[model samples]
Target chain A: DAGVTQSPTHLIKTRGQQVTLRCSPKSGHDTVSWYQQALGQGPQFIFQYYEEEERQRGNFPDRFSGHQFPNYSSELNVNALLLGDSALYLCASSFGVIRLGQFFGPGTRLTVL
Target chain B: AQTVTQSQPEMSVQEAETVTLSCTYDTSESDYYLFWYKQPPSRQMILVIRQEAYKQQNATENRFSVNFQKAAKSFSLKISDSQLGDAAMYFCAYRRRNAGGTSYGKLTFGQGTILTVHP
Candidate 1:
């Protein structure tokens, strides 16, 4: 009955560098989605992965990519990061694509210098 | 495109009292879902309550309830007998019911409101 879990609670990277954040979805869940929450702001959807394939994406650029493993875990990779990229990266999991209400993780705080 | 808005940036209420947080969203889709998520200082996003567009009855969870107005496109959360633990960042989000393919499971969130429960 574990909830969604994320790794690297906090990270710091310089501009132009790349970073990868990980997430383990809740038990019995198969869909994973990533979101970026900037300071004093709500989370913005990044992308969603289902069945080891990307099923949906937000308005994010190509630099932001993600992958879903067979086990339903996910990784969010941000390449050539900028200072504005610093934010709390959250992961949410649901039973399937049709379930809009998701369970979210504690999130990874990323600081791009 | 769907958009959520929480006009109030911050609000405070005394402990054991009641408080209401406002949330409004813009969407062209007739059928969808609206959600209220509570993010505590620990930064964990917890779902408070949700309402379906097609449901006329408001959604309620324990002391938390929503005032959903489909025509007005408004969804407000009311917390009764609030406690210190109720202090957190409240976010309003929306999702289209007919979403499929690359749009499935995506949520559009509002700017958020910071609720402070005074003890």
Candidate 2:
């Protein structure tokens, strides 16, 4: 059973540019959640996706959005990137909407210049 | 606006010793869950332990155990016989219970505690 997997372990983009980070959940998982962790801070909730639909979102602005595919994989898209957006974006997967013990990916370290 | 807070920004413990990291949370809802996640330099969030709001008994896994105080809204984690592998950033998180176990989970996390295990 493969654990959660994220692509483009590191990303660099200029301000105003857009970036997309990807995640594949562990097998048998159906829900995916995205989080942003700034340096020296814990991961902050971004949004959660289940059954290809966004179920809940955090205080993040419209600049942060996400999608969950039928296979339960997910992508986090950040638009109009600001230097503040430079952080580690983590994707966590669970077996269901109420599942505990979410498994997180290694995360994509985004650096916005 | 539920919030979780970890008072300790950094902590160090000698190998084979015991250490406790403190955590406190503020929430209006009575039903919820608390979690402790460890992130090492690799940055993979690993579930260390979890406690349910309804359960009075603390949760334990291996050498890790939690001191959950529902009335105080406090959840502290204790690691016994700590090893070098225990050194990591420990985050305290909260998730309100969702209907039917939908797992529509959104965690409110504290500004994590950095644990250093000296051998």
Candidate 3:
């Protein structure tokens, strides 16, 4: 089975511009979560989506938003990006009810200029 | 609020030797989950081992094992017979139990521990 898959492996955007990153959850998984990993640091939770609805969010601002589609694919959109937003955006997937181990994807590297 | 901390920013061990990386977390809840993830230069997060808070026995996987001290809220990873492939950045993460039935599966991660296995 394919693990979590993310698109646009690397991206470069200007400050104030918006970008949307995509993620396909692991096969048979329903819950999707996004994390931001800055250089030399571990990933920080951004938000989680379940049943097409956001279930929990971290300390991120309104600029960080996400969507979960019917196919278990998800998108992370950041509005008015800032230089601080440049980081490795990782998407992890797991089953909501079973409390299974998380499967992570190769993250999207976002660089805001 | 929950927080995870990895005191060792970087550690090194010779091949075939043993190394331990320390991690500590703060949380009031008694039931939870702890995880150790390895990220290489490829940047893909890979699960190494996990320990359930309620279990007193340490979790072990082949050459990788964890020392879980629930009372002290300390979780340390010990890699025996280390190999060159073991060189990577290790992350310790925590997740609270879904007490309210809203299981979002959110994870709070510590800074990280960089491990270098010298061959």
Q: What is the TM-score of each predicted model, taking all chains together?
A: 0.96, 0.98, 0.97
CAPRI accuracy category, model 2: medium
Q: Comparing 1 and 3 by TM-score, which wins?
A: 3
Stretches of candidate 3 off by over 4 Å are A97-99, B100-103
Query: Each prediction's Cα RMSD?
Result: 1.8, 1.0, 1.3
Candidate 3 on A14-64: residue-level lDDT in tens? 999999999999999889999999999989999999999998999999999
Question: Residue B109 of model 1: what lDDT?
Answer: 94
Best by DockQ: 2
- Model 2, which residues run further than 4 Å from truth? A97-99
Give the per-residue Cα lDDT of candidate 3 at B86: 95
Please list the residue runs of candidate 1 whose C-alpha ends up more than 4 Å from where it truly belongs after superposition. Answer: A97-100, B99-103
* Candidate 1 interface CA RMSD, Å: 2.8
- Candidate 1's error at A6, in angstroms? 0.3
Native contacts present in candidate 3, fraction: 0.62
Q: Specify the CAPRI tier of model 1.
A: medium
Ten residues in a row with the worst lDDT in model 2 chain B? B98-107
Which wins on DockQ, candidate 1 or candidate 3?
3
What are the per-model DockQ values? 0.61, 0.78, 0.65
